[model samples]
Target: MAHLSSRRRHSRSPLKAFAAVAVVCAVAAGGAYAAGVGPFDRGSDAPAPAAADQARAFLADWSGGHYDRAAARTTNPSRARDVLRSFTAGLDIGKPRLTAAAAERTAGDRVRVAFTAKMPVTGLGTWVYKSHVPLQEQANGSWKVDWSLGLVHPHLSEKEKFRLERQDTAVPQVEDRNGKALTGKAYPSLQPLLAQFTDGGGRPRGSILLVDRVTGETKRTETTFGRQAGKGGEAGDAPVKTTLDAAWQSAADRALESGADGRNASLVALRVDNGEILAMANTPATGFNRAVSGTYAPGSTWKIVTSSALLLKNAVTPDTVVDCPKHLIVGKEFHNVETSEFRGATFQKDFTESCNTAFISLRGKLGGSELGDVARTYFGVGQEWHIGIPSYDGSVPRPADETEKAASMIGQGRIQANPLIMASVTATAASGRFHQPTIVLGSKDGTSTTPLPAAVVGRLRTMMRATVTGGTAHVLADLPGEIGAKTGTAEVAEGEENNGWLVAQRGNVAVACVVEQGVTGGGSAGPILHNLLSSVPGDPS
Candidate 1:
């Protein structure tokens, strides 16, 4: 009878068979649930209720930064976790939360999930972005999220990553002393502080999504890192007022770029009376600021300091006759440029002509520390300066031997200076006193030496004037300004070309320039100085 019943049941219609199977399944499920081993139990083989449900759970874990758990629910767990960590590293966004999610069925056993994420940005209020997550039914009958960069951000590609970085505040406009804007768009180097807030390629790490203080709408998005955040901020901050003169800056920029002729060059100008920076420019617009930070031999420019020491000691006067020779032997042989010597010329003539051997002959009259002392006191060499930026204070070490002393007198050997230091030296001669050069207003003032004697300064001015009128800087004599200048060709190697230098004072502006691998100061750097000085407005004469 039992066998007959079983046969009858098996022969029943499909609907009856299905009904019996359902009853068996329900009973088994109930028993498993009582034992905490049903489909919903941990590690159950049963699939998720829906693709949407699985996606939402994964998003919840991801949004909360539970990357391990979230990645485990993705098809590529290890790779997804690594990418997630990389994207979030250094990200400064607030705790992320899903604001909304919507799921739509795509192809068979696949679902597309679109969601909105909301997170707070530092100093930028709230940020919102959309993400798309795709879910597919796995071979195990469970739904797993298909990992992709788009899962992090829709705009991201497979090779890209998403991050919530701190946006640079809008940089304030940098203005000159006369309140004219020094636009980076016009001259990229004018943005001195830009590098502090940008990547290597000059791209801002973050952008400021500026909102109207009155209206809730976004005013604009700025990518520049300017003085908005203390000169390195985004665009909305107050304009940074600098001591730079825009016209002079433009002229300097032009002169340096064109005059360099493919060589590295830099120029810096300052007001003689107060040491306010008028212009600072460099060729090639490189990140390394050669104007202030460069260290090189001043060549004959060191004669300015040597002459100051001699004048202070009354060792020689402008009219005092000195012997000029083709060569002089101290510890080492020193010779004049081109072996052209001016025999029995006045000290003033020697200076104007830049007689290297003539200046070296005066070393016997100087004390061991005289040159260094004069350099520090009168020219501010080796003095610490705070110019609101990086800079090098020139070094004039006390010479240890006759060779070093002779070389030091001619701005060579161990002597080192930059365009800024040389410019300040000229400014001192122009003003009869020393004032540290400054680029930013209200910068800390460095110590100044005692004022030069009226007689010493008067003679120094006369010598410099002779330089323009009949000496190495004769090219600048016809310039409209009452100019006094010095030219230098610093020998860098035994046979290689020398570094050219020029320091000049026109009206109240003192300027200095240097060209690497240039053969002569007058030939390479004189025209540049003249171009810059000629561009100045008003009659300097």
Candidate 2:
């Protein structure tokens, strides 16, 4: 039965798909992602040459994930369907690749055919085995595969079946760029992500065995995707490598632990050059991975996009004077933090000071859909990103009302983001281009964004520099390096406390974090960002 599992029909009816390629192709390829190779017997003298062809076609339908089609080619259709489903589904062996040998000729009037199946056992290695089937002639002058319990597995009779049982569900070690094993205990913040780091959370990874039905005994041990190695049950899947830097991960964890003040918080750091995730950490680690999955209003950190839109449209320059009032009403009321007014301020001062009214006053300078369009086009907002893991790619829908538009100008209302999105946003602002953030370096990942204009990039960079040096993010100015940052305090509800946000880029690292209900971004998330930034070596991140 194990050997029979190896060869499946690679072609379909009339077997023209098998006309040229035959057993020779199957044996030559040696089954490394080899599928769809079929058998061709030209003018064979076997008494039931057509019967062998029927059996070959039956295996083809079976290996193609068409169980009912394969069963239709069998004499006992109902029984064949049930056993076939149980064998593949129960064993958790995926649609296997079957390599069929040419028809076997029996000296008498009967005919039989043999084949090999390369069954890819889920979360385990492939099990290669061979099996054979007898073909019988029907009254209608047609040949069909004889189906029985033994047809599914030679060892499986009417009283026996196959079982893939779990023995150890412990996940294998995850490695870093240097192949150093990274553990949850050594880096508690990564506990929530380690299992998924391998292949993004599927069936459990552990020791599994195929139980033989007759005696209920087991044979063979396993690994996942990785080649089988070692003696007995000691072998396992090779560790998957990620781009994470352990030292930066440790520093990011410590920063959150000490700076989050026991509040629910999440932080993420990535290389500004390639968008490779360096560290992802959450306080009170192990429940939810808010660092990448959670969504909240980015508050003022969204102003980065807002500034880009305004600059791209030539609405305002860094020195363009814009009025900042204690209260400015577009439809509803909007005000600066603490309702403190900067009577006459440049766009730079308004940005550094985080004046809600200052930015809201220019809402007329943008169309309701302009902001959302620019966000999706340049920032990858609302676009699919396959980061080798699941994540809620942020949403930035167009405003529904004047109030929503005013609120969105300051990163509220319908605008939503997490540390993951904001970290990428910061990276885009810093580099003038965008790269989809990815932890598993080999995962299918790439992005093409129209580069932010050079004039806009320079203005935004220096304006953010002023923010760190003389405005809201001054907490980071005293640390070191030329840094650009934005702070935000997002309103959740009328009575509830707001979520804080800060996203920035310094040297080669772009970092972002959120402290839920922590009041202001600078005061809450800034310290955490500071600690992480201070740890950035003079070398590349």
Candidate 3:
């Protein structure tokens, strides 16, 4: 509105120009402060703090899947980059999220960054891991992270990378005598039994219990079979060999499965000449190996040991006559399985028929420890064994009273054996000497008594042979090869059901089978033994 407009405008330009210059300087100063470049300086010369900052930045990038960027902060950038890439690719987890990251000062211009990663595993939900990364300040005033495989996982080794893998390898297969596979194939009943030998990792070890018959050497091995997680620098398991006969094992499995009648049954077989196990099977194929570990009254099957003791003592010969009554009383009243009484029968005839009365009547003739000694020293009963697996060898305690002794004579009182022990008894009778049964090759041979008298053994063999031909085991008379057998119905209690048992020998193979709560030994267990023995390939006549 004044008349001097041009002069006024020219004069105000200097003041306005000065104000604009001052405003520009102030904005530049504020920007420099915000960037930590001027007044608030975090310069490269700060060694320890710089290293800590670099460590934090590296961890942040790593957790965010910026692997290349993260690795660029490491001393060995190329290797670090490759390792990071490979590890993340191999993981079965989702991208990791940084839960916490903190950098702390260490000695000599170094910094340690502790971090936690929250990763989601495919099916296992979330997994949290904590680790530390070390960083050092360089001479050039820069910081670099140390590259190590352990930076990823504490268990990782140098030249190794993290990888998600199975915990176990495949289970080792069980093999037969001819180097054929017995287990690992689909045998329904054997599956559960085989599981007992496996560990929580699902891995199976080589059968260390197998031994060579002629060499007396063992089949020991350090190899393991079954599923297990692979370690960083470790190899997988090797296959295992066994002493089982595949054919016989299969036959035994089938026999028990078919005849078990919802009850438990077990069977075991061994070579008479050498103690090599040929077959071991159980029905309801479970982790419990009843064939070798079961403890039950052996019943008349134990008469083999009793008779051996009596023969060694000259108490009675196979041809000697004995009385068989329907009922006899000692400390307790004892009765035979059959009501019919044979007033006078040869000892051989009574043994073939499994006459409990005849054997019980002679309990007074046995010395205090004679029967138990024979069982322990000659038959290897009730002895600890090293078979590369857990087993209950057997138990034969000396009876303290007449009633107990009478029951012991018939394999009742304080006399317990599994199928393996019974099979061993038959094998000993067949071989004319006691040889401890072994599943692992090269295991220590158990203690045994002096060689049995050949003449006495010869007569015992004849008596057992007559059982298959004309006695309780007559059902197996028509079987191929020279057969011998004995049947037993072990009374568990006065009123409870009895366990059926049968032991048999054919050529070199001897087998024993037991059926819990079965009708009778000859009726239930005899056929199973026959089935197993018949399947074995016999010697050429």
Highest lDDT: give the candidate number. Answer: 2
Overlapping backbone residue pairs in candidate 1 total 12
Per-residue lDDT value at 28 in model 2: 16
lDDT of 1 at 376: 84
How good is model 1 by TM-score? Answer: 0.62
Which regions of candidate 2 deviate over 4 angstroms? 1-169, 200-236, 539-541
Name the regions of candidate 3 deviating beyond 4 angstroms: 1-170, 195-236, 537-541
Per-residue lDDT of model 3, residues 166-278, tens digit only: 33323445554577654544565456545333332122322212234356444432122332334332222333345666777787887887777788889888888877777
Residues forming the 10-long window of minimal summed lDDT in candidate 3: 23-32
| Full candidate order by TM-score, most accurate first | 2, 1, 3
Q: Report the C-alpha lDDT of model 1 over 121-192, residue by residue, as the tens digit.
A: 322323467777788988878889988877876655543334343543345456778888778667655655
Off by over 4 Å in 1: 1-172, 191-236, 539-541
Q: How far is candidate 2 from the true structure (C-alpha RMSD, Å)?
A: 17.9
